[model samples]
Target: MTDTTQPNTATDARPPAAPRRRRRGGAKTSPDARVAPPPQPGARPPRKPSPVLERLFALYPRLFGARFVPLKLGVYEDLLARHPEDFSPEELKLAMGQHARSTRYLESVAAGHPRHDLDGNAVAPVAPEHVHHAILELHRRRHPRTPADAQAGLNARLVARVARAIEASGLPHHDYAARVRSRDASANAVVDEALITLAAQAAKREALLRAFEASGRGEPEFAEMYGIPLDEVRRSLQQARAARTPAT
Candidate 1:
């Protein structure tokens, strides 16, 4: 009877599991789950040239055509001398163009050619470096004192010369000299003011040195005279004394 009346064990056995939903690309489902990929490293950016640099590039051929090859070469040589580390062939080319323009302008002015004007006067352009050299020469002649004094004097003379050239060439005097005079006056005032400040500093230093010397302490008067801080002076004196003292 037990065998004949057995419960429906076939239906009780777990019904067949539902089929898994497939991905759109029919890829197999990973048992552990998938992770998003990491981002790749960014690429290095390109270096940009300056506007002045671009202008120089444009000017090179124009300058070369004007029979200023020697002048351009000299300019490159000077640039290389001044900035050996930074100077490159491209940079040299730019510098030479600038120099050529400057030299040309100077030559034109000297030869009685018209100064630069908005009007079509065919004014010759000068190189900035050449003008700088000429200005320096003038400054040296006018002021035989310090380099700073010579530079100031030269700058003044340059402005005056530019004004005169403009007038002689029938070009509008751009009041360049007047502007320079104003700037020079301001600079001279600053120099005068700085002299007073420097004198005060010098007096303070002298007084400090004198005090240190009179104290007869281990401190150095030179440090005080040179306006070094008390802590630094003390440290320097200690080191010096230690250096001079014989090792036990």
Candidate 2:
């Protein structure tokens, strides 16, 4: 005898798995969780403007008048933000002076750039383009376009140094070295004139010293006679003697 038994289908059956939903905002998480990369170490932050820049902003009115400041200050600030960090305050001022002497600026002056309105203000704001041109020109000046430009600058510096050395030479001295070093006009004749002046000064100093010694170091009388400062008489005499002394 055989018995027919119906197996339970519910116990044998499994429901379909629900579809996997993606993450709302980010990538789906993988079975092996990913670790975020660490931030790079030792990254230098952007540099800020030097303190001299602040002073430059303060001096703008004196450097460039209201007429020149036509654009909103923010515009100039934006341009300055692009100003090279390597440029120093002195260099910036130098660039500005160079710009002022430019033929374009001079032509504008001839055309009355400094003209004023009835309200005691500039007729109009200075052309922003003009200012920008000056900025570019200044950068060019700093960079020096041609070989001659750099040489010219060096020559100017050498000439100035020569002039200073000649002026400071208190005794008869031949600065042939300076004449040779100066790339510009030789100041050799200047040395001759300076020597003459020094000789005269020496004569005067010697007379004053003789009078002082004769008067038993009387400061007031010697100073009155020479018409020199009484307070500086001792110092002047000492300096004069030192100048005449040859260096060992």
Candidate 3:
């Protein structure tokens, strides 16, 4: 006789399943459950490089073959924007051409390897800043600001420097008078000697201005190197301005 109440053998064969564990702090979550986090505000989407930039990159190596250096296209773009359309293209070409022909740039190209130009002549590469400066030179040349104008500006700076130096040097009249009295020299002799010393100092100051300008050093660097105070530099610049002013 068949037992009607007997459990199925297939159901009894499998072992009991383990209970799911919960997080120690947070609420329990299913393995399949997911929480999508909020998106970041003002997140920029990926940008495609501009066609002009891509073209420039493509032509760069060919233009300055064996000496191409990667640079930001935005810098040239800004320059191109500010420039007059009539000369912009020509200026860019000129700058790039100069870079290609520069011996310094060519040497850098072959820094560690045997790099040669199309005609098999070795060449150097330059930094983007060099090219940028070349572009600036073109603009400056076009503008033609006179050397005297430049000198005038620098001289104003020079006067400021001189004033600061004078302050640091103390009162020249008092100093000279004390020395003259100590030596029992005539007052007229002291005045003459002071005049000669003043003339020499003026020459030295001019020389210093030339040196600083030639070296391309700013005020801070010049002051630090020569032990002159910044205030003195400003004073010298002011004195130069006064000297240059028209007698009105």
Measured by TM-score, how close is model 1 to the native structure? Answer: 0.25
Q: What is the C-alpha RMSD of each candidate to the true structure, in Å?
A: 21.1, 26.0, 21.1
Model-by-model lDDT, in order? 0.46, 0.49, 0.48
Best by lDDT: 2
Model 3: ten consecutive residues of lowest lDDT: 153-162
Q: Judge candidate 1 against the unseen true structure and give its global Cα lDDT, from 0 to 1.
A: 0.46
**What's each prediction's TM-score?**
0.25, 0.30, 0.23
lDDT of 1 by residue, 7-45 (tens): 568775668799988879869769676775555579555
Question: How should the candidates be ordered by TM-score, best one leading?
Answer: 2, 1, 3
> What lDDT score goes with residue 232 in model 1?
72
Relative to the unseen true structure, what is the Cα RMSD of model 2? 26.0
lDDT of 2 at 175: 43
Q: After superposition, how far is residue 201 of candidate 1 from its true place, in Å?
A: 0.8
TM-score of 3: 0.23
Q: Rank the candidates by lDDT, best first.
A: 2, 3, 1
